[model samples]
Target chain A: MIEALQFEFMRNAVFAGLLASILCGIIGSFVVVNRLIFLAGGIAHAAYGGIGIAFFFGIPYIYGTIGVSLAAAFIMTAVTIKAKNRQDTFIGVLWAVGMAMGVILIDLTPGYHVDLMSYLFGSILAVPSADIRWMAGLGAVTLVLTILFYRDILAISYDAEFARLRGVPVNLLYFIYIALVAVSIVFIIRVVGLILVIALMTIPPYIAEKYVRSLMMMMVLSVLLSVVFNMTGLWVSYHMDLTSGATIIMVAATGFFISLGVDQVISFSRKRKTQRSSRKMLKTKKDAL
Target chain B: MTQVSPVIQVQDVSFSYNREPTLTNLTFEVPEREFLAIIGPNGGGKSTLIKLILGLLEPNHGRILVKGRSPRKMSKIFGYVPQDVNVNIQFPIAVMDVILMGRLRHRGHFGINKQDRQRVMELMTMTGIPGLENRKIRDLSAGQRERVFIARALAADPDILILDEPTASVDTAGKTELYALLKDLNETKTIIVVSHDLMIVSSYVKSVACVNQGIHYHPKNEITETMLQMGYHCPVELIAHGQPHRILKTHGDF
Candidate 1:
C-alpha cells in the first residue's frame, strides 16, 4: 500500500478516502443520533438527479448535483415537518423519482459515454486531485461549521422544543444542517456511490455510539473507525480485485455486528451475575430463618 | 403595590389545524408567580394551548402575549419541559450534557462558561440527582428522567417554567415528590403545567384552567361541576376515587 501511494492517482484515491471518512464520521453521527437515516437515504438517492442534471446540461457535476440535492432536501424536510407520518411515502417517492430521472437524463444525453457503474457503485481509484481538493475544502467547512455551532446543534438535536425555548434558531439550523447533509452525501457518492452511501454514513457512527458518551466523542471515534475501514477495504480490494466501495461498507457492517454481539454478551453476563447474587442472598436469608 | 404586568395573556385566541378548529375564543391570563395547571381530556386543546404559549404555534385569529411581548420575543424567558422529550434514548449524551443544554441561551462564542456549569450542577443538586450527572440519560429510570428534564428546565433560570405532563411517567411516590419540588420552585418562578393527573393538580396547583375547545380559567383550585361537564370525559360526580368497583360505564355515563 505504501508503494502504491507513489502513484498520483493512488495518492488522490487515498486522500479522497480520508476526506470521505471524515465526512461520514461527522455527518453520519448526526444522522444516526437524530434518527435521520431515512432522510439521509432520501437525500443520497435524490442527489443522483443532480448528477443526471449535470451530465444532461454538460455543466460541472458538483455544482449541479449539490444544488439539486439541496433543493430536494429542503422539500423533503418541509414534507416531513408537515406530515411526519407520511414522510416515508414521500421520501420513497422522491428517492425513486430522483434515480429514475438521473438514468433517463443520462440516456438522453448526446453522445454521453461515461461508466454508469462508477456513479452507482463508486470509483475511488479513479478520483482526481481536483476532486480530492474539493472534498478536503468541503470537509474543512463542515468541521468549522460544526465547531462554531456545536452548542446550538447539540441543543437542537437533543430536544428541538427546548432548543426553541432557548432562542436557538431551530428551523434555520435544521435547514442548514440538512443542506450540509446533502452536500456531504454528494461527495460521499464519489466514494461509495449513491446506493451504498447510507451504509457508509450510518455504520461507523452506530458502532461508535455504544462506546462513546458524548456527540463529539462519538464523531471522533466514528471518524477513526471509518478511516480504518476505508483504508483496510482499499487494501483488501486491491489485493482481491474487488469493488472498493462495497468492500468498505462490508468492513463497517462487520464491525457493527461484532460490536452488537460484544454488547449483548457483556449485558448478558452482567444480568446473570446480579441474578445469581440475589438468589444467593435469598438462600442466606432462608438459612438464617 | 406596583402594577406589574401579567406573566402571560391570551386574548380571544383561536387556533385551527387543517381548517378545523382546535381551540376557539380562548382568553386567559397568568399572573406573576402563580402555579397554574391546565387540565382536560385528550384532544381538548390543552397541548395546543401550551404550544401557543410556547410560540411553537400561532393563533389563527387572536394574539398571545408573554410578559407583554409576543411569544417569540419572550421565548428566552420561558423554560419548558415538553411532555415527551422525544429523544433517541440510545443517542450518546450524558445527563449533565442534557441539563446544560438549558444554558445554551447563556452561551457566548467561547462556549459554556463556569457559571453555566455551576448553575447546571446547582439545579441537579436541587433536583436531588447530583450523583447521576455523569450517567448516560438512557440509563435513567422514567422517574429519574423526569427529574433530569425538570432540572434542565430550571437550569435556564427563567421567570416562567412550563411543564407538559411532567408526572405522566412517574410512579405515585415520585409524583408526590415532584409536586412537592414544583411547589417549592413556585415560590420564585411562575409554574404552568399541563397535566392529566387531576389528583395531583388538585393537591398542588394554586389555579386550574380546563381547556377543551374553548378556555375556562378557575382562579382557585376548584373543579366545578360545570367545568367538568363542559369538556372532560367523565362528570365530576361520577369519578369516585379509591373504589375499584366504580368505573364509568360509558363516555358520558353520568
Candidate 2:
C-alpha cells in the first residue's frame, strides 16, 4: 500500500477518496436523516443521463453530468414535493430512463469502445488530478453551505412545516440541498461508480447515527468512518488487484453488519443491567418497609 | 365569549385542493390569551385551517390577519406544532437540539450561544423534561417526546402556539398532562389546537371551532354533548372521557 503511493494515479485516488468521504459525511447525513435514500439513489442512477449528454455532445463528462443531474434532481424534487403519495413511481421511471438514455447515448457516441466500465464500476486507481480539484471545490461549497444554513437545514430536516411556520425558507433550502446532492454525485460517481455510490453515502452515516446523539457528531463520525473504509478498501484492492469501488463498498457493508451485531450485544447488556437495577430497587424498598 | 383583543383573524377565507373545496367562507378570530380547540371528524379540514393560518397554503379568496399583519408576513411570531413531528424515528437529534430549533427563527446564523442553551433548558423545565436534554429524541417515550416538541414550539417565544393532533401519539394520562400544560401556557399566549380528542380539549380550550368544509364557532369552553353532535354534523357515538368508552346504547336496528 505504501509502495503504491509512489504512483501519481494512486496519490490522486487517495485525495479523491478523502474528499469523497467528507462530502458523503455532510450530505449523506442529511440524505439519511431526511429519508432521501431512495431519492438520492435515484439521483445517483439518473446522473447517467448527464454522462450520456456529455459524451454525445462531445463535452466534458463532468459538465454534462452536472447539467443532467441538476435537471433530474430538480424534477425529482418537484415531483416528490407535489405528488404526495405517487413519487416512487416517478423516481423509478426517471431512474430507468436515465440509465437507458446513458446506454443509448454512449452507443451513439461514435468513438467509445474502452474505459466505459470505469464510469459504471469506478476506476479510483485511475482518478485524474483535474477531477480531484473538482471534488475539492465542490466539497468546500457543500461544507460552507451546510455551516451557513446549519440551523435552518436541521429545522427543515426535523420538521419542514414547522420550519416554514418559523419563517425558514423550507422549499428553497430543500431545492438547494437537492441540487447540491445531485452535483455531489458527480464526484461520488468518480470515486465509487453510480451503482455503488448509495452504499458509500448511506453505510457510514447509518453506523455513525447509531452511535451519536447529534447530527453534527453524526457528520463527524461518518467522515471518519468513511475515510477508514476507503483507506482499508484501497489498500486491500491494491494488494489483490480488485475493483477499488466494489472493495470499498464491501468494506462498508461489512462495517454495517458488524455494527448491527454490536448493537444487539449492547442492547442485550442494557436490558440485563436494567433488570438488575430494578431488582435492587425492589429489595431496597422491601427493607425500608 | 369574552371578546377582547384579537390576535388572529380569519375573514371570509376559503381554500380548495384540486378545485375541491376544503374550507369555505370561514370567518373567526382568536383573541389574545385564548385557548382555541378545532375539533371535527376526518376530512373535516382541521389540518387545512392550521395550514392557512401558518401561511403554508393561501386561501383561494379572503385573507388571514395575524396580529393585524398577513400570516406570511408575521410568520416569525407564530409557533407551530404539527400532528406528528414528520421526522424519521431513528433521526439522530438530541432533545436539546430539537428544542433549540425553536430559537433559530429570524436568527442570522447557526451557533447556539449561552442564552440560546439557557432558553432551551428553560423550555425543557417548563414543559417538564428538564433532565432529558441530552437524550436522543428517538429514545424518548411518546409522552416525553410530545413535551419536547411542545417545548420546542415554546422556545421560539411566539405570540401564538398552534398544535395539530398533539396528543395522537400520547396515552390518556399523557394527554391530560399535555392539556394541563397547554392550559397553563394559555395564560400568556394564544393557542390553537386541532384535535379529535374533543371532550378533554373542550375542558381546556376557551373556544371551540368545529370545522367540516365550513366552521361552527362556539365562544365558550363549555361545549355540551349536544352542541358537539351538531358540530360533527352527525351523532357523537364515541365519547372520549376518562377512558375512550362509547356512551351510545346498542343499536336495536341490528
Candidate 3:
C-alpha cells in the first residue's frame, strides 16, 4: 500500500486530495452551519456552464469555472439577501437554469466528443501536477481567509443581524463568504462531480461538528476526515475499478452513519452513569435520615 | 440627566411593504442615555420602524438619523439585540464563539486579537454568563440564548442599544433580570426596547412610546386606559398592582 504512493499520478492524486480536503473542511463548516448546502450545489452545477464556456472559448477550465461560478454565487447571494423569504424558490430556479444552460452549451460544441461522465463523476487518478498546483493555491487562500475572518464568519453564521449591529460589515463578509464557496466549488468539481460536490463539502463537517468544541476545531477534524475518506475511496477505486467520486461519497456516507452511531452510544452511557449516581445519592440520604 | 445629542432620531419617515403603508410621516427622537420602550399592537409597524432605524430596511419616504447621522452612515455606532436569538440555535456554534463575533468589525476580516478576546470576556462578565463560553448555543435555555446575543451586541461597546421584544419568550424571572440589566446599561448608554408587555415596561423604562400608525411619547408613569386603547386598538383597564398587575381588555380593532 505504501509503494502505491511512488507513481507520479498517485503522488499527484494524494496531493490533490489533501488540498481539496483542506478547502472542503474550512469552507464546508460554513456551508453546513449557514444552511447553504443547496446554494453551494446551485453554484457547483452552475459551474458546468463555465466548462462549456471554456470549451467554446478555448480558455483554461479553472479560470472559466472560477469566473462563471463567482458570477452565479454573486447572483445567488444577492437574490437571497434581497428577498430572503423567497430564497428556496429562487435558488431552485437558478439551479435548473444553470444546469440546463450547461447541457445545452455542451451539446452545441461541434465535433467534440468529450467524455462527459468523467467530468460529471470525477477521475481523481487522472489528476495531473498542474491540477494539484491549482488545488494547493486555492486551499492556501481559503485557509488564510478563513483564519483571518474567523470571528466575523462565526457571528454571521449564527446570527447575522446581531453581527451587523456590532459594526461588523455583514454584507461585505457575506459576499466574501460566497466568493470563497465559489472558489472551493471550482476545485471541488474536479474531485467530485457537481452533483455530489455538496455531499463532499458537507458530510465531513457534519460529522466533525459532533466532537469538536469550536469552529476552528471542527474545520481541522473535517479536513482529517475528508482526507481519510478520499484516500480510502481512491484505494478502493484502484483495486475494484470503481468510479472515484462515487466511491468517495459512499465512503463518506458510511463514516457519517458510524459517527452518528458512536455519538448515540456515548450519550446513552453518559445518561446511564448520571442516573446511577443520582439513585445512589438518594439512597444515602434515606439511610442518613 | 446630562444632556447630549439624541442617540436616535426619526423624522417624517414613511415605509410601505409591497405598496401597503406600514408607517406614515412618523417622527420621534430617543434622547441619549434614556431607556425608551415602544409598545404597539401586532402589524402596527413597530418592528418596521425599528428596522428602518437599524438600516435593515429602506424607508419609502423621509429620513432616519442615528447619533446625528443617517442610518447608513451610523451603522457602526449602534448595537442591537433582536427579539429571539434562538432563530438558528441548533446551528453548531458555541456561546463564547458567538460573543466573540461582536468584535469582528473592530478586528476586521482576520481573527480576533487579544483586545477582542478581552472585550468578549468583559461582555460575558457584564451579562453574568462568564462560565458559559464553551457551551453550545443550542444547549442553552431561551434566556441564556438571549444573554449570548446581548453579549455579542455589547462587544462593540456602542453608545446605544436597541432590542426588539427581548422579554417576549422569556419567563418572569428572565424578564426581570433582563430589565435590571437594561436599567444598569441605561446609566451611560441609551437603551431602546420594543415590547407588548406594557406593565413590565412601564415599571422599568424611563419613558414609553405608544406607537400604532404613529407614535405618542409619555414620561415614566402608569400606562393609562386611553394610551392602551390607542396603542393596542382596544379598551384596556389596569387591574391590581403591587403583587400582580394585569391589563383587562377585549379585542376592539386588533
When 1 and 2 are scored with lDDT, the better candidate is: 1
Worst 10 residues of 3 chain B by lDDT: B242-251
Q: lDDT for model 2, on a 0 to 1 scale?
A: 0.84
* Model 1 deviation from the true structure expressed as Cα RMSD, one decimal place: 3.8
Instruction: Give per-model TM-scores.
Output: 0.93, 0.91, 0.91
lDDT of 1 at B228: 67
RMSD of each: 3.8, 4.2, 3.6
Once fitted onto the true fold, the runs of candidate 3 whose alpha carbons sit more than 4 angstroms away are: A285-289, B1-5, B106-111, B232-239, B243-254
Write model 2 residue lDDT over B1-254, tens digit each, in one string: 44598888999999998878999999988888988878777887889989999888999999999889999888878778877764567888899988888888536544568899988888888777889989988889877888888898888888889998888788877778778888887888898988766555546777777788888787765444544565554223346554432222233522
Candidate 2 residue pairs that clash: none
Which candidate number has the best TM-score? 1
TM-score of 1: 0.93
Model 1 CA deviation exceeding 4 Å by range: B1-4, B107-110, B232-254
Could you give candidate 1's per-residue lDDT for residues B1-254 as a string of tens digits? 34546889999999998778999999888999989988777888888898899898989998999988999988878888888754567778999899988888663334688888888888888877878878998888877888899998888888899999988788888788788988988899999998877565566888788788987787777665556678855222234565423222334544
Q: How close to the true structure is residue B156 of candidate 1, measured as C-alpha lDDT?
A: 81
DockQ of each: 0.74, 0.63, 0.56
